[model samples]
Target: MDGFDETFDWVVVGSGAGSMTSALVMRQAGKSVLVLEKTGYVGGTTAKSGGVIWVPNNPLMRQAGEQDSTEAGIAYLEALAENLPGSTPEKRRAYVVESQKMIDFLLAQGIPLARGADFWPDYYDEVPGGCKTSRTVTARYFNKAELGPEWAARLRPGFVSQPAMLSEGLKLAWVGRSWKIKLLLLRIGLRVIAGKLTGKQWVSAGAALQGRLLKAVLDAGADVRIDSPVRELVIADGRVAGVIAESGGERRRIGARLGVLINAGGFAQNQAMRDRFMPGTRAEWSNTPEGDTGDMHAEMERIGAALGQMDQMVGYQMTRMPGWEQAFVKPPAQSLTGKPGAILVDQSGQRYMNEGGSYELYCQTMFERNRTVPAIPSWAIFDARFAQSYPIAGVRMAKMHQVWKDSGYLKEADTIEGLAAQIGVPAEALQATIARWNGFVDAGHDADFGRGARAYDQWLGDPFLKPNPALARIDQAPFYAVDVVPGDVSTYGGAVTDARARVLRPDGSVIDGLYACGVSSASVMGGVYVGAGASIGPSLAFGYVAARHAAGLDNSL
Candidate 1:
């Protein structure tokens, strides 16, 4: 403390969902809090994401008349985390118990949160103790103008920036088919017009959630700074005491009397770290913001924090498009390939894994398939019927950009064989694969991989399709193809923390006064994603745990 330029009761690094939650917790405890963000924006990758928080037994669910219990939630997590390296029994129980408390705290502080769609089933709804009715939560739409100009401009944008809620936005894909969806679009359009007239900038999804959290943190009088990156963690008396960081082109040593919490995200933007930990993936394919470069990861490792699950990522399949490097949201192919009348095949025109399932498992399968075959860039083959009925990469098939074909991102042909030839796959093999898929459609069941067998898989499929929503004949003419890569939402790896969110050493001893959450720590859900917002829910929960621990408060409301 003698050499420190400034001091605070708690110092939090990286302004993602967890960072904001921890800051609010400390502030509520009457402790001085400082939140440092590496990027100019206050929200990290959370801002660009869907911002769904998968909290089991949350108040929103209870209020909605959905039945859930802490024991049931723990059972589901145990099933998912069984034999996984990054999770422990204590951590799993703590996540289920503390998640509701965290949400309650947010509500008490007046954060606008509500339950997501009841139809949005858990990714593994068929698993024991899984809530098929859904346990996801999201923030209500927020007007950025509420944050004032400076803060509003600094809030990172989400993929879906419209004023509509996420539940309404999901129906957008079926707008062409449903009159209900068309009317919903009209409502959203009117909402946007109203915002424009009132000089209000409304944002939805992740941006909306982060905006509400940021507003609360600012209102609580927490000192928040951007463009301030922590370079090193300073240790005193064999514990973390402060951080050496840079701000306004000046280096400063800031001490945390209680502790320093790192929620700075993972190395999804760091190619070197990806090559070292996850070898089969490319950093460019990740949708995480550039600030996810793992600077704090290296710093934490230098301080003897044990890193685990470096090989895992929140896999989100995508197809590259024109200007993809600068695109706000990468062209998602997760739902596209799983929709009716579409199927994914390897380079040899062979169908491997089930085309419909969790996107995390989908990309994991891509890497796994690549180990034995050329599946890194698989082919998503679809027919004209699908083209006319659905959208690809946010553009309807009839209105696909010319640059898509010019850039070799899209391939079209009058026949299945012709499309296969164009994509450099064996025509005969492609034809046989399509024939087999069509047979499955006729029989109303997938014998090979059980495509629509699960509730989650059907949710990813076309809801309008009959029999099996995930299965359809791919026999129509004018077939098309696009290259699908194992893109990622964020890398799922980092310093291992205990149940209390304390960074731990390799020997299972805690790094005194040091905490980590979000992507900065190994995922609490292990390698499997149980539902949407699994990452965000644990992040906020652990962040709350970290702050309460730092403030010498117990885990109670």
Candidate 2:
């Protein structure tokens, strides 16, 4: 062991959005900070996510003339989170009161934001307090070159870049739509190609926001060390004073006189943890990297730090390539662009939820149903027309014939009974399920599970179709069945803390010099995600709050 003393005003563990946000806030306050990242690169799961920040009643919404009030937002979240046992009135109120301030703070830092995507709907639009107006906001496009060579190398590669450029946007849209979306997509394509030819790398949305924040942190002269996992938190006099970090095959203590913040993400990659905490899950993660091992959770628990929302996690049950654990599943859009082609079913051949529901709802439903039945390997059965029209997991079904066959993911047959036989289901049961589904499509109604039922569920459907794109009848021939396993973006449970972002002891007293944010702490949303970007939004907000508080600034915007 080598002995080295490197001191900073604040020491932050993890380089994810939350940790970086806190570090940047402190740096802006003219405080010297040291950030320790466990992975080889910066940007935790956030880099790989859809980076829209879902803050209701933000400045962008106001500018767009979308009527939103803090009270309404609060009410809506309260209603949505009411189902979860961990949700508390205090957390919900805190989220609403501080959300606008967090948005304003980011905007002040030269981060531009666009209006919430109007096309995307809130998860529960039918519920009261839901707003049709866009509240999600993202940064203006950023160029990777702006970060300089050294910083760019530290960022994770192969992550989604921004600006919704032509190439990527078109490909994403093509996942579930027909050629009718071509013109809207072609315009984006032209801009992307033009930017590339002109030596400009325009990034937008999550990528842009993350890039800007990273650049700002680096610009403020904060030192970031990659591949340095914090092994332990040194507590003295009931306060976190510093950390013992393992990096470069050596261990050393880095002390922070002011405070130590833990933002080291959730335990998505820890298969054992997932199996224990989140039962029946396949533990397939499409996260940024594989280094997130819940080191913070273990280290904090060892010191008697209280844990919150331990049973909940952000579930993303997508289809994946067999044996290739990291790939996410895409929706079924092949033959059903203009007609219904496939249906999602549990082992009992019964519909459980709308197939078009966001990954959160899908995973929740899977887990909920798995409690009583075998939902580990659900099936998405479709027809040959769907195979021809839309792509599965981003590849045209025809193109992936070899891969699917080799991987045992593709099950095909000329008749429904044959397909059921291959899928190990009762032939009569599956046929009956399909027959009932066809009736619902023909009558333009979904009585039984309400497929294409709600406005929210139909938001992502193909606009070219007369009825709901997500509600096509699966009556066509050459039936197909692809398996969907339980997956996730990250775990949601972790160390317990308050609105001020100070970590609390199990007895409810604040750990004076310790702060925690991101998935390293229980979510303020109380385990019910409202929309896209909810995970990282609170992560960044609380990080700012924690840093400001640690720097002795009043948490007043």
Candidate 3:
């Protein structure tokens, strides 16, 4: 302790959900824990996301009578993972087994948990052992008052700041079609009104999730420091022992007797890193907060931690609108492009891939197509039917501003050929593509790419559609096009670690006393995103695993 300004049994860098979870685990073991966050906010990128956790055989799912097994979960992961780097058979098994335990622990601690919509399908539900009924879980709505005014103000806000649960938020897509959705809207309205009278600050999604975790950590007596950025991991006797961090406008050395865990997030905001690894992507297209600049990634690498899957990201396709950079939520094109009466086309006005699959695969295909075609800024062609029936980037089609057209964010024309001219694609090619799409709609089958063939694809489509939910004739007048870019919620690659969450060297040797989880560690799902909350699920699982190992306990089933 003499070599440090202060010391704790465990030091967690970053205030992401996983970091808070690890802190709770340490405190539950009666060990001292310190959480150092670089920003004034307590929650990291996890707070801004959907906050869904993908867990197979979770207690919430079992309570809801949803059936799942550890073997089936492992099979599902193994089917997709398939020897991909950063994911192993053992790691996959650990994720399936320990994630359930982690969720159980959180629930036992009184954290409000709920199962995601039963209709929500896994990204690759067609894969072996994949569940058509969702295995996702989310935190219920939490009032910020639970953390008191001081701590509540520091909780990071989500893109959807509305207090609606994630399930309620999904119902917005069926607004005019479903009677249940109408009822849900009425309920949401009343809730909003009640909040206006009660002075209660409610949050849902990622904000609710991290808020609950932060509360648990605080209640367990863990120390959390905001605006404290760890600059270096102090090594004593060739092992991570402490950290040199900036605290209260001064650099302070803080020691960790047990170990140091890095959950500090990925390098989504660092343009240089993006260019080096993901050459086609841009930092401007990222949805993560500016604090996710990959400082911990560089530090870990410098200290001999092997990095893997450096080019991967959680692709979340987004459409740019006026002032998109400043907007809390950029208009999402993931669902819109998959809906009836709309199809995505490259610069040459050619449809290349299935448009109604997972957003990750959609963006990956966009990049893959860009290798030979200019598809980075692809065109999403839609007709008046789609425009009138659905919302674009949360704005009703009738409410669209003339400024959007003037700024070229939304292009419109009375005919397909005219719309093609506006977007600088060949008129004939555009005409041919639309005709082919209309033919597919009539046939009730997408022979080209099978857009609506999967349950997951149809979930994103309009259920009211007859033949195929994801297919409709795009022959209506007043065609429109918008720029769809490969935006991301966060980078997916980072420091390589073993199944126990211990950082590993290139030669498979462990870095003693150093661990990583969340996006700071190489993803456990490999290159493919397995489900709705695959990112956060493994983060929580590995966090629990790391803490249990540090406590000299076994986490594996």
Candidate 4:
């Protein structure tokens, strides 16, 4: 052993939104805190994700003149998660109440958030209590130049490159006459080029957010140990006493007199765990640095922590580069929501669910369909015209055509039947499905699945198209299909915790001095995702709750 010993009042493991929030909360409460990260860099998957945090009825929403109530938000989630496990009344209440507290705390800490004014749309928008609001908040794009040399290098390069503001990659295919987004993109592009020309590095959204959080923690005199993986939780007399960590190939014991907060992410990268928990899932995750091995869950389980909602995991159907292991292809919003895009079909070439649904629902539907049929190698078919008009993810349609073909994704066919045949689907069934879809397009209404029928779905669809930009017939020729596999942003299930953000035993008592949040804890959303920022909202809230409760802040509840 190299002989390194450190102690703090609170120790937070994992540097995602949850861990940062917890650490910051504890710091604000006048507690000395230390954050231990396994990876060389801080910021977990959150630094790689869309930084928008969804908080219904938040100050930002109210300032934008959007009316939302806690009851309405709960109603919306309840309707979507209807029969799902973990959707308890207490959990729902805690999510809403704590969410506001998180927003207030962040704002007080100089974290500026712009309202995602037009981004509201629950997966099931037609359900009761679902409405459009600027509830989601995003940070202003900060240039990596502002973070200084030492701190910038400490960040994971790829992780900070996403939630690619209109600057990095446009989320909406077209700006729809929004000069703000256009200007932002232009500014970002110029800055990136300038930085490249000068041999300087650049970072955005998730990275920027992480940098801000880290700066706040450091400013508050908190210490962080990189490449230190917490191996075991030290429990004594039914309370977490400290942690055993491996740093620099040597074991070091760090005692946390107050608590140990575990935010070490979920098991998305763990194939064995994925296979065991989410059977039949192609558990490819585009997450933070790949070292996230679900250590928090494993440690908690060893200590007899009760696990909740192990069956749930966040899912995204990803478009990947054919031969590259690290490179990924982001699918265009138009490809999923626009009229030209065909319904996603499984390996057996059968229709699964509404292709215009949110990514979470899309994954859920794909998983369910895979159980009944071979949905692993599913395809997103579209016409040449749609490809030509809209940007598909980070790549243009023409570029995507080449990349998909080269990557063994795009399957060209002169007709739908030919395409179906190539994909190993019953040609007749695919033809019939297309015919029905065309009928809906012509009638300006989707009767079966109601694609583009709701305000939220429309938010993701083309706004210029009448009736619904998301609705269109697939009668055009030169049909094309690209394979899509179920991918994930991160895993959702981890150590189970209560409303107070306290880790719970199987018998439902708090594991004193221990707290878990973020992807390291069971999602408060249950199995249904609400919108873009749902993951981060609960993460921040629960982290705050955990820190507050741990610091003995009137833990009456």
Candidate 5:
């Protein structure tokens, strides 16, 4: 590809983690870049995410005393995934191998970054070669002033209401434990005081991450257009050359001299796409932002770019009310049903899998069981004690919204049998299930599904609880049941890409000038939720890779 003056060297579609990184990288490499976003908001699904990035064997991991290896990461990917399109040995090696380069690139750009939570273990910590410590990093507390007033106002809020580091959030989650919580509060208080004295206003998590990238793009003089979506790709000489974007009832043809990269996210918001590809999931079942409607996916399909991973999503366990199912919310530590006195039961009122695994794993269980059982909209039963301990969603026990209760989102009763009756499940079966679960609780072990057996479960559990922190007898009065279902933090399926992040045709040849990353590309992790920030890590790496190659720079290292 030859560089053409008057046209941008690269045109990036979308404003998520991947697109922003691509724009930043190209602009930094002295290439003109343009970003087109479908919505008024810049951060696509990323703005709605918890912004820790998983990098295998990251420098921060080493500095934090975790001797993780790329080999171990490769092994973990291979062991966990099966028959995923891009999980080849070479690509997996590339993802692991490029972690440091990406980290170095962001650091060189002066992005504030530090080690994320050490307690944030890999999704499967018990498996062989699993990383038990922080291989993830987050943007350090960023002063919103870095984005200036207008841009700062547009940045999305963090996933959690708590604007603190992941480590601090983990410590602050120990609400029931007196001593540990007090100490954690004292540490946070000191940090807050120091910040006030310095007059540096700080924000953490996804907002900080996107703000840094957005700032880098803006500072590098990249052009960004909001409320603009690429509706069609202009293909010349069997290569993508430009895009026709529509805005305000008019269309404009924007030429790209280098390449067109579509990081416009997945079909999570499209019900037709979900039904055809990912079954049993509707638009209401995902945590993806409103703009991810798979419009670009449809546009690219017309150009013969091969796509896969439609059957997969980066699934999450979520609670949904009846009519408000489409607007799913991520579970805070308080809503995690694996906590003491809470249990998940299918329509038949029976436990299926361990309630206390990774959220994605929990979703996998629901999907697998739904093939034969009524597990899609499972019931999460908890005693009054559990509700009193933590907020369900954002509502405390006393604050359970009237609309939520009236709309059949929550079923409440003074006894488990009565609660089961209200929810239309078998009272006898639920009673038996509770009796069996209570036996396991009293015996200090889960004899049925091993709920509290794994380190991953205990990582989110209360340390001070006896027997098992994730288990408690549900013998208390005023039982409650909420409808929990499958949801996604992001979709893993998208356009297939090669080693260089170029979109591949059905016959496996590159589409010449087309590339993709983030949720728009088939996940490099093979749809396996490897660890915290897994999706963003590959997005950053391949976004960098796509830009470098499109600019005629060496990407073969």
Candidate 6:
């Protein structure tokens, strides 16, 4: 590293939502900001996401005549942070309260945000103070022409990246909604034609979210160095004053006048960290970017930055095809498990949970099951009929039997017993689990687990199908089985911070000139997934706070 006297008012590590948003805010405040990214491009997991930011009571919701009160949102937050040691009322209140103001600042910088959906329910709609809508916000489809091809090509894709509206993509993904899908496709076609005529491509979801942040940073003249990673934070006079960054295998010392904000994401890619902090996680099943090694967490911890929430992660049981690496290759685990005709079972071939639960519950259950039994990598067993209705890992495009067999990811047999033997589970037990599931399907109720009892689960499945679309029989021949692992959306555990986004020590002392956000910091929800966009939304809010505080500006906004 060479410390050739490069300095800035603020230095931020990582190029994810938290880091980028913080940089944008500081730059907009007329402060020189330097963004250091480990990867060759910008945007981390935020790019490969739905980009929904949960703003409890933004103006967009009010304009639509549906505004959730701060009191209600705070009530929800209080319930969420109940048992969480690191989740404080101050942090939760800070997020839900300043959400609108932080959004206003970003919107002024041309963030292109809008209310995510009129009905994108909180993941925990059943939780107290939770609302069906008026809490989620995201970047609407934005023209990539603003970034041009250079930066545009660097934008990563996750889930849906075609720049269509989030609502439209949700409709298209719902295979059962044929008419709605057609309408959305027609609208998309028109947009594509219009984009072609105007010489532009579009990005949406996570890509758009991070893209907008990056654009704001660039437009405000902030310096962002790609392929440069901060290996260590520089402490000067008991304060974080600079960072040692690596660029092209050479080290450079960049000084920060204000502080060092670490938004480098979590340790989802770090197996040793996973084994140490999050034993329930597996490196292969992670959905975060490969660059997310959680190295910064340990680095900060060595400097006395207290770590908490090490036991929390957000994930869904997911499938991996022959070439697919991350579990996010298909519809999320909730969609797969909640749908009818599939039963998730442990090594003993016994059903473990209500298949119609949310993704967060899936991770929590997998962790609990692994405690008593070897259930980290479970199996999803179904029949040919299920394949006809829904395809696992997009198997419909290829020959399901041949491709899955060749890949060794899918086991198929003419009978349940044979399938069980192929997968190496108890034959009788497998057969019994399926039989019980079928009985529940026929009875039009999940007698044992109540799979389709929740409105959320039912909404994910085909509403018009039979008694309960999430309950179906697996009696058809050519039954299939695939391994489903506890794949995380991201690790939600790490260095602890306060509502002002200031890092804390074990002795309850603030680490001056140091801050953290995103999964790099312990979540405000205390590792709980309250709804879609929970992580991204709070990341931006606190990152914004970290920037304002570092810049000596009023954080009350």
Q: What lDDT tens digits, residue by residue, belong to model 1 across residues 1-557?
A: 78899999999999999999999999999999999998899899999999999988899988988889888898898877754445888888889999999999999999988887878888888787888778999999999999999999999988776788998998888888899999999999999998899988889899999999999999999999999999999999999999988999999999999999999999999999998999978988889998999999899999899999989999999987677777777789987888988999999999998877788889999999998989979999998888888788677766664677888888999988789889999999999999999998899888999889888889889888887789889877888999899989998889999889999999999899899999999998888988999889889999999999889898443
Q: Quote model 3's TM-score.
A: 0.98
Candidate 3, 290-391: lDDT as tens digits: 899999999999999999998999998999988888877667888779788889999999999898887778888999999999998999999888898888
lDDT of 2 at 374: 74
Q: Model 2 scores what on Cα lDDT?
A: 0.73
When summed lDDT is taken over every stretch of 10 residues in candidate 1, the lowest stretch is 77-86
Question: Which residue runs does candidate 4 get wrong by more than 4 Å?
Answer: 1-4, 82-87, 158-172, 175-202, 285-288, 328-340, 400-403, 554-556
lDDT of 2 by residue, 105-164 (tens): 878877666654665667666667776545676666678688888777777643455346
Candidate 4 per-residue lDDT over residues 1-557, each given as its tens digit = 12226678899988877787888888888888989999888887777776667777778777767788888877877776643223466777778877887888888988766665556566666777776644677665555555567767786554345224522353434555567657766766777677678865555666666777777777777888788988898876667888888988999888887898888888877878778887766445444358767778888989988877777777766655454355532343324533445566677666667777777778778777777788876777777776666655445767557767766666878898888877778888888877877788888887887777777667766766676767766767788776776677777777778888888887878888888888788888878777877788788888888888888874765
Better of 2 and 6 by lDDT: 6
In model 3, which regions exceed 4 Å deviation?
Answer: 555-557
**lDDT to native, each model:** 0.90, 0.73, 0.89, 0.72, 0.79, 0.80
Tell me the spans in candidate 5 whose CA falls farther than 4 Å from its real position.
1-6, 160-163, 175-180, 183-202, 321-334, 401-408
In candidate 6, how many Å is residue 152 off? 2.5
Which candidate, 5 or 6, would have the higher TM-score against the true structure?
Answer: 6
What are the TM-scores, per candidate, against the unseen true structure?
A: 0.98, 0.91, 0.98, 0.91, 0.92, 0.92
- By summed lDDT, the worst window of 10 consecutive residues in model 2 runs over 329-338
lDDT-best of 3 and 5: 3
Model 6 local distance difference test score: 0.80
Candidate 5, residue 294: Cα displacement in angstroms equals: 0.7
